[model samples]
Target: MFTPHGPSLRELAVQALSSVERGYDLLAPKFDHTPFRTPDSILQAVERALSALGPFDHGLDLCCGTGAGMGVLRAVCRESVIGVDISAGMLTVGRDQEPRPAEPGPRVAWVRGDALALPFGPVFDLVVSFGAFGHFLPREFPELFGQVHSALRPGGRFAFPLPAPAPPSSPWYWALLGFDTAMRVRNAVWHPPFVMYYRAFRLGDVRRELERAGFDVELYALPEFGSRRDGSPRCRMVVATRRDDSSQRREASHSSLAAS
Candidate 1:
């Protein structure tokens, strides 16, 4: 258990043995109380970075979860915002918890849909995701990005914060490495695997995949997170611009998310 309000250890173990969708459904109620929830600091930092780039007309929170990114969208996007996720349970929590804004902002729509088979046209000017990629296997990267490319209008951007990979010398690296190994072993013997591996989604590989998916990618350092000793950012935002070209179609590599 992460806290008194978070899921207990037994609950987590049960969720881990279930399918991804079902697992999230079980955790949906207490998701916000968990350390797994995207922290307010990260969300605020992302909003700060995006505000400089926009007055965006429309935005999508891919794998939206309990609608944390919805606030970010409301701050920057003018007309409307959409949050798409596979878990109905998660969506319910977001819908019921909608904050009454002091001033009315973007029209919020929460849709139940798969990120891989997104139910939208080239409708969004911006797509933002917070802390949701680890649920996907690396093999799904191409198809996942393809969906994001299709969802965005021409010249639209797919933006999400990416924390730098832990260095091999850091304790975090070994911790994540061990966690991933345990997950692999669990899934090997279990039916309906719960996929959550921190190290599996490599940023270097992700950047290459995004380019392949026809995105002109850019990385922006999130100064709020400061920098590593090597002067690289502790966290960076990946801003992948969508381009529509027949030649560029095999390209675009990208999420629908689990809450984390």
Candidate 2:
């Protein structure tokens, strides 16, 4: 659901018909007002979790649309922060609209770059991304994680909160399934595909891929969200630390992205 100030139905329709980058560029202005933006509660929880790990320096917010995840980096990191995204329009909005903390904080900057082809060297100590994974297909996980790993200093972390899958009987599950189906149909009929699928990124595949990418992966339960029927966390932050002295070897430069 979108707010009154969020993109109108017609505007959303036009965006959906465009490429992902162009669509986000069109939606950038009102992104923060939409439900699509990471919620304050989720951000706050991530901030709290990362705070316990504390005093990180030179953090990076990967795919930092409208800079929603930048606040979390600001809370825990001691030095400067950078927000990297593919959409120039999104980066513009992120650089302008994303506010500094009322208290003193690190210098924040935004960079426009592809996730599969990060421009930075191994310099960041921490990296966080919120709600951007859907844009990447499952096969892109290696390149995506590899890029994040390459951008981080040894022992550096790549973190993001992943929500548990909706129950099979829940309407939420059916809704997401339908949405993915519709996206598939739309992409088949349209050019310059708008790629977004709620059900494509699987947790098991993600964890394994992170491991294959030389990350020592760990899952931290976010207590803010309650447990499911099986007593599992409703949300868990996947904290993957790049192995010290490990070099990034996997390359997806020529990998084809399959539509899910």
Candidate 3:
């Protein structure tokens, strides 16, 4: 699935054997040439959805490898856009690549930091991530979601696109199941294993966790992808809003105690 300019088999093998951060660093140069980068169609659909929801002041692209999501942010945000990723190499490549010509849109910056331990305060009005969830395990979901929530200002949004799984009886389903099974086996027998779990990302579980983290969550279908046999959405955009009242209540409680 890689282009002619993409990483070779041996290069991919070495990356697969390294830690996630190091692997991504090694893959950064050719990441956009590979099938692994978030598809352009998804990015365009996200831009369209966010345009309807926004006019945001500042936007953050979480785990923004090669800065593809930054393009989407620039389309809707007004003042500024920031991209945060753990891989310094990825950030370097992103920086070297020429961004789209500046216009009446948010300016862009790239930051090197872990998504789980983001270094920003509640300064962003919108946040977006794409194709990075597979790197995180199920248990990490809460902490990751918490970080995203913490990074956003009150009423700020965190959005991502999620595709529905192939039907259980379909060949694609079996292929993915087989790949996940292989990954499990590899991790079981390996050291400092890479964690990429496909089945661990369930939409229902994700929505519940987002709610638990004090986000008001909603889902919107991307009609360009079409629907399933059951007539359910084929792909959905998850938009979670950070709680304004939670912060307000905390401030009020602190003030009350201080007065007492």
Candidate 4:
């Protein structure tokens, strides 16, 4: 559901017909007013979880639309924080709307770049992405995770909040299923397809992909979102840390000596 200031039905229709980048560009102005932007509650919950893992230097907000996740980075990171996104329009809004925090925070910057082809070296200590996974297909997980891994320094973390899958009995489950089905149909009939599927990003598959990308994955339960009937966390923060380079080299050296 959208607020009164959110994108109109006709505006949303036009955006849906365009490419993902273009659609977000068109929606950027009113994004915060829409449910699409990460809620403050979720952001606060993530911020709390990440605070214990801090004080990081040089943080990145991947696919950082409207700079919502950037706020979390500012609170936890000590040095500079960057927000990278593919939509120039979204970046512009973020630049113009970002406020100076009361407490001294990291220097903030925005860059327009595709998530799959991030234009950065292993410079960041932390990277956080919120509500941007649906734009990526299941097959793109390898490249996406690989890019994040590459952007992070050795032992740096790629963190994100992942909500538990909705149960079949819940209306949310059916709604999300129908939405994905509709998106598939739209893509089938349209050019420059807008990819967003709610059901595609599975935890088991994601953990495996993160592991394959050279990350030691850890899941921290976000108690703010509470638990499911099975007593499992309803939401979790996936903290995937790249291994230490020194430790990696030692292991490699040991392997070479053993082989010789």
Candidate 5:
């Protein structure tokens, strides 16, 4: 569902065949006009939810293509905000299009970096990523989560919105399933695979991986998107806070002393 100004079918076909980085680079200029960009409504909903949890000092947006999540960070964080992405082209567009907040806000900066090996220390108080998970394979979850944990200070949060999976009865479910299956087939035959799968990121598995990566995971329902047939939230924000390393070390010491 792209607009008149969005990438054409030919452009999208070329992107799908190229490597993920190259594909995004090719699409970056028109990405906002495509359905691939994070929707404004979703962004506003996330901004509202995160504003309550914040007053943060430094913030980072993981995989911040075109910097859509920068607004959310600026709203919640106090001092400075950075958007990290792998594609230089995307960063260029983001820098060119970045909007200044009406009132004074955090200083905004863009960095070209990979999400798996983020080029940062334990400095950020808040990190938010919007609709970029599909680029990462499920097997990379541990490294990805660990990278985010390492980027955050103790008690810092890594937040992202996850929509509820469509039910089997819904046409949307079938559509997503078909898309993922096709992507798998394409990757199997193609070189420099364009990895974009809609159904691979499951909530249960993600929570477990986050906990293993030293985060206390919590889910906040976004009621603005309403509920499902089972009264479950249609969309939710995953807020994973980095656990205090000192507390963990203390517990480990106690366990070792008990064993002795």
Candidate 6:
């Protein structure tokens, strides 16, 4: 479901045939016009969630295509914001359409790089990614999560919003199934396959991976979307923190010595 300004069918066909980075580079200019871009509603909800958790210093938007997530970071982070993506073309568009100025409008920077090999130290206080997980395979989860953890300062957070899947009997569910099936077939037969898998990113799997990567994970429901048939959350905001255990242990040891 693309707008009139979105990529045409032929254009999409060309992109689908290319490698992921090249395809995204080709699609960058019109990405915001497509349903592929993270919706404004999700961005607003994430911003609202971050407002309660933050007042962060520096933020990073991982795989930040066209910098939609950067908007959320700009709202919450005070010092600076960085958007990193593999596509130079995407960064170009991101630089052009910068976030609006508010009180302490965070300085925005863009870097073209792979998510698996992020080129930054433990400098960021917050990291956010939106609508970019489909590009990564299941095995890549640990490495990606590790990179995010390593990029954050002690007690820094990495957050993302995930919506619950449609019911099995729903038309949307079947459509996604068919799409994923087609993508599987396409990748099986294609060369340098464009790697986008829908079912590979279950929330349980992600939480486990984040925990393994040393993040203390928590979920907060975005009440705006309401609940499911089982009364579970319809959408959740995942807030993962990188904790400094050495500091806590040292404090505990000092308190024990003082008590003794």
Point to the candidate with the largest TM-score.
Answer: 5
lDDT tens readout by residue for model 4, 85-180: 999999999999899788888999999999999999999999999999999998999999999988999999999999999999999999999999
Inter-residue clash pairs, candidate 6: none
Q: Which 10 successive residues of model 6 have the least lDDT summed?
A: 99-108
Q: How close is candidate 5 to the true structure, as a TM-score?
A: 0.97
Can you write out model 5's per-residue Cα lDDT over 82-168, one digit (the tens) per residue? Answer: 999999889999999988668888899999999999999999999999998988899999999999999999999999999999999
Q: lDDT per prediction?
A: 0.91, 0.90, 0.90, 0.94, 0.94, 0.91
- lDDT (C-alpha) at residue 51 in model 4: 92
Pick the winner on lDDT between candidates 1 and 4. Answer: 4
Can you give the TM-score per candidate against the true fold? 0.93, 0.92, 0.92, 0.96, 0.97, 0.93
Residues 1-260 of candidate 2: C-alpha lDDT, one tens digit per residue: 37789899999999999999999999999888888999899999999999988779999999998888888888898889999998999999878877757888888888999999999999999999999999998989999999999999889999999999999899999999999999999999999999899898888999999999889999999999999999999999999999876243223322333321
| Alpha-carbon deviation at 189 in model 4, angstroms | 1.2
Q: What would the C-alpha RMSD of candidate 2 be, to one decimal place?
A: 6.5
Q: Any runs in candidate 1 off by more than 4 Å, and if so which?
A: 244-260
Top candidate by lDDT: 4
Provide the lowest-lDDT 10-residue window in model 1.
251-260
RMSD of 1: 7.1
Give the C-alpha miss distance for residue 50 in model 5, angstroms: 0.8
**Model 4, stretches more than 4 Å misplaced?**
249-260
Candidate number with the higher lDDT (3 or 5): 5
RMSD of each: 7.1, 6.5, 3.6, 1.5, 1.1, 3.5
The segments of candidate 3 whose C-alpha lies over 4 angstroms from its true place after superposition are 100-104, 246-260
| lDDT of candidate model 1 versus the reference | 0.91
In angstroms, give how far residue 149 of model 6 lies from its true place: 0.6
